[model samples]
Target: MTSSELWSRATAERYDAEESENSSAAAVEPALAFLAELAGDGRALEFAIGTGRVGVPLRARGVPVVGIELSEHMAAVLRRKADEETLPVVLGDMATTVVPGTFTLVYLVYNTIANLLTQDEQVQCFRNAARHLAPGGRFVVELGVPPLRVLPPGQVAVPFYVSDHHLGFDTFDLVEQTLVSHHFTRDGEDGRYRRGSCRQRYAWPAELDLMARIAGLELEERVADWHRSPFTGESTQHVSVWRGPSPARP
Candidate 1:
């Protein structure tokens, strides 16, 4: 509902290059396979489909995929890869956008739900997904577990990635369930780092399940990753599926 979090054109231009590793075949294939299986001869919808990293390939795998994107800059980058006919992308917020069609599968990946920045907006996202689902269809989400356990005492930030050119860390506001991810990337050989930050609201698995319930959905399956790994206490992320109610017989 808020454009305050919309990604900037500069960020969109560099998004693919900066996230090259994640868009690689190895990193994306497992998720594609998992989603393809769930799609099962029905169409799929992607929330926050930035640059078509997953949607483009999923469509290539023979599944029809539509996207809802909040950032025009991001959608423009996606347009460069696939035309509107091949992969239709509606420019709007994922929390309330309606694309005028039902889907057998609706999915949000890479901790995108946290981008909503508020519990109410996130819950509305679940409701929106439910609204687009055909009877018995599923909504899937891939999110990271909050890293609070790593904060021993008064520590506020948790470093996720550190390298010669890029440094990534997250600072948490536990009281508000919000965190700001800070990224510093070195450009060329300049030895200077470009700093960028994104604010997001973190949620627990149980809280997400409750959101699904509020949207008239039921938890179906949950795993640590697309590979079906068991979600143990030590897991850093999760892939969860919630199914919509089936239609009643006449």
Candidate 2:
């Protein structure tokens, strides 16, 4: 059985089929507004910009945006949406890929950072984000908080979502701070389930902040979502911003 993954051709082909936040203009508009405000006449860079779902819409808002993608298959899918004149994307990994020039804002959204699968690699991702940022520029990340609290004693798995078309859950290795998302979707005409998995290393909010600190970034703001709602204990995910040092101080 074939399953979709970050670097898989099948995943690239069906990446946008789901009704995710990227699928709706209502959800994307607020994110565009937030990013455009931070961009402020400077360019923005997106890490792991799979299929231009956000980049195309962000560019439509008049913000100049470039992207770096690890998978050429996924980048190819993005090319169908917009040409280089509208959105230029480079083929490279977010943890180490470098594009010439700095950006006023660099963002990794939709839990993409979790794809790194290790703490050291995740820190490298933060450093890379800082490397792309101009003085006083900000790095924004949309990530889910680990679902550890929901786990009862001796339970290593948690169901994150269930719907008529899909059932999604996560299995964790707490000691290693690692997790894998298991997704079963009924895309077949016969209604048979197709399984796909993505493994990631989950980090706490504070741990991510520390990674930012190591990368010479400071925590600026953290919200529940793109709406800028205050993050609370009940919030499962966060949209966080970390600012690089101002030029005068650097």
Candidate 3:
């Protein structure tokens, strides 16, 4: 399916409540704190800010947060959490969306960059971020390393989780890096289920650095986690910092 169709279906489905709770904004407090420090009293933009998972809490900390999301359904979920006037969310694709005003920081986290499969689209995303950034602004990206090369054939990895009535299902995909998870609950007489799925491409840290260079940005820092730990070969995830060219210098 096309990316648009995939996203539409994924967002329309009712995601497992337990999964959402477990992966709540509070869970990524460390990352949020790093972002807050990076912004340093400047406005921030979150790409693909689904359900306001990061934006909501970032705003609560008195940081002006704006979001660009492609899925209207997910955006609706975010809106329900906060007043429209308080958090401004633009419904559009992160790869090509154009929003008014410049921001000191722009971030796309949790492997969201891999959602754009092609190299062209990924480079476009960086350019888009550069376009909206103020002088010397930063674009932060967080993603996991690809495990395809190491995983044994026919072996699947944990992709998603859902729980209902203390019973849950975690879907795994061996052939494709995708997942379709369902969680059902029985309430005495009747039972209901919530289902959702997501498919993403994995990326390497080095490749992303080249993409950033092509977008007229420079990699300033690479850390293994939110605490700024030095990145190592064993690290499975990364938080990369890219700096846009200053308007005065360029």
Candidate 4:
């Protein structure tokens, strides 16, 4: 299936319930604190604002929140959670969508950047974030580190999660720098599993730093997780913040 089709109506309907851990307080608190601190009293823009999962809570915290989503069905899911007046959404691709007003904070969370499957498109996404930010505005990203470690010597696929209700794993194309995530969920009493899959053009942390620099942003902080922990070799995911230049700088 294509990348755009990944967020189909059926998927949108089940997203929150199936990935409840992402919406949990424990998973979301660190991100909330960091973004809110950067935004202060200014507005924040969320790319791929699926179901308003993080946006809704951030808005409730008093930071004005707006969204750009490529899938109408996904936005429809978010609409059910919030009204247009409270949390307005624009139906367009985050990479190219131009919403009204500049933002103090523009963010893409939950590894949403991986949805753009090409390197050029990924660079465009960074440019897009810079375009929307006001001077000194910040762009935050939360993503998993590429799982090359799992694929030792000749291995191609490795399991990341195994459980009763869900089974998650990834297959890598080392030469192409791409990976496909395959997920299976057992939601019925009959014990049959439903499968969903998506592809991502993975990038290294240093490569992302270069992309940010190319897009007129500078790396401000790199944390191992949402809790602002120090990054290390063993960390699986990262929450990175990049900033546009200050008024006098560039």
Candidate 5:
């Protein structure tokens, strides 16, 4: 039901290995700490919880965590690491799926929102996050800033990583506000490179703030990273938190 691209079984099977860097303790700890602090004494929900990368650990850290994932293939990989009761995940669209309880923290990390590919869908995602939040709860999103500055007057592509075995770049379409990331990884023994590409819609921080406002949430904090570094023009990525309105009391 989601307009986002579905990750295939092949992609899901290789996800954990290919994304080892993100799964490293260095990357997960700080983010887990940040989330755990927000989820204090309350439940946490993750959008697109691929292979339980963060959810399983967050749950282990004494937080109740649940997930909504679009791909059964990806969810299947996660199921292997944790049982259903430990980290329950519903298979559905993050923008429209309704999981049964409220959450103090609802988070979407690693530029996953860009997968929605349309402004309306992205906006709906914010609304969905709001819908799942308890009063005064927070919705967090981790996203990369559009790298348009790196694009020259005529150039439309930017290389993010280049290595002897792996090469990665992103090509942009300014008119559509979209980008497609291309990756090529070489098989050590075979000497053949495998290629993959994913298309996503990129959004600016101001635009995301507006979407949060439209969803009846207020911007609470925005930082350069999970470490709480200050966000500036030079920052390439951001972690933003929006707070839902508190209940009215007489």
Candidate 6:
């Protein structure tokens, strides 16, 4: 199956339930904190705002959030969790969607950049983001470092964790950069388990910065985490902030 179809099915079935609790709290809280500080009484835009994991909580903090999401299923999920339709979400790909109005903050989270498989598509995403930002407005992205080079050839199983009753296995196809995970719960009744997978391309931080430059945005900051720690070599995730070029400069 195609990558997009695979992701649509996987997210619709098991991803929400698996990530809704502790994982969401750990990941989204820091992101929200950073967003809150950056926005500071201004409007914000969220690209690929899947399932409202971050958008819902951020909205509660009194920020007017507009979202661009590609999957209808994921958008529906976000709509259900929102209070009084607080967030206005447009159903379209982030790479080309034209969201109305300019914003002080435009953000994307959770390695969503990889959703654009080709370099041209990724560049388009940056341009689209720039189009929606007011001068000096910031565009923030949270993505992880690519781990493909470290893996051995023909190695499908990379164990995330293993306990007496459960085994979390992450399997990947190197050429396509697709990941399939199977969790086996042993203590439960026979065959009581969940299987899900997603396909995403990986891009380096430097590459993303160049794309931002091509879109007339300049890198303003790179932080290790949402708390604004300095980014270092050991950092696994990146929080890169970019600013739109001033109108008079160009």
lDDT of each: 0.95, 0.89, 0.76, 0.89, 0.96, 0.79
**Which ten residues in a row are the worst by lDDT in model 1?**
1-10
Tens-digit per-residue lDDT, 1-35, candidate 6: 11233246445545577665634678778888889
Q: Name the lDDT value of residue 239 in candidate 6.
A: 91
What's the number of clashes in each of the models? Answer: 0, 0, 0, 0, 0, 0
Model 2 TM-score is 0.95
> Lowest lDDT 10-mer window, candidate 2?
1-10
lDDT of 5 by residue, 82-137 (tens): 99999999999999999998999999999999999999999999999999999999
Residue-by-residue lDDT tens digits, candidate 4, 5-91: 347899889999987987898888778888999998899999989899899999989999999998888899999888999999998
Q: Is candidate 2 or candidate 5 better by TM-score?
A: 5
lDDT of 2 by residue, 1-250 (tens): 0111357787888888864655788878888899999999999999989998888899988899999998888899999999998999998788888999999999989898888877778899999999999999999999999989989999999998899888999999988888889999997689899998888888889999999999999999999999999999999999999999998942
TM-score of each: 0.98, 0.95, 0.80, 0.96, 0.98, 0.83
For residues 1-250, write the lDDT of model 3, one tens digit per residue: 2253235545444442534753565667888899998888899999988777788888888889999888888888778888777889998888898888999999998778877756677888999999888889999999876645565666555433334453444344544544333444444546654343445555578888998998889999999988899888888789999998877843
Give candidate 1 regions above 4 Å deviation: none
Relative to the unseen true structure, what is the C-alpha lDDT of residue 162 in candidate 1, on a scale of 0 to 100?
99
The regions of model 3 sitting more than 4 angstroms off are 1-13, 20-26, 153-196, 247-250
The C-alpha local distance difference test score for the whole of candidate 4 amounts to 0.89
RMSD of each: 0.9, 3.0, 4.0, 1.8, 0.8, 3.4
**How well does candidate 3 score on lDDT at residue 14?**
45
Which runs in model 2 stand beyond 4 Å of their true positions? Answer: 1-6, 19-21
Cand. 6 Cα-lDDT: 0.79
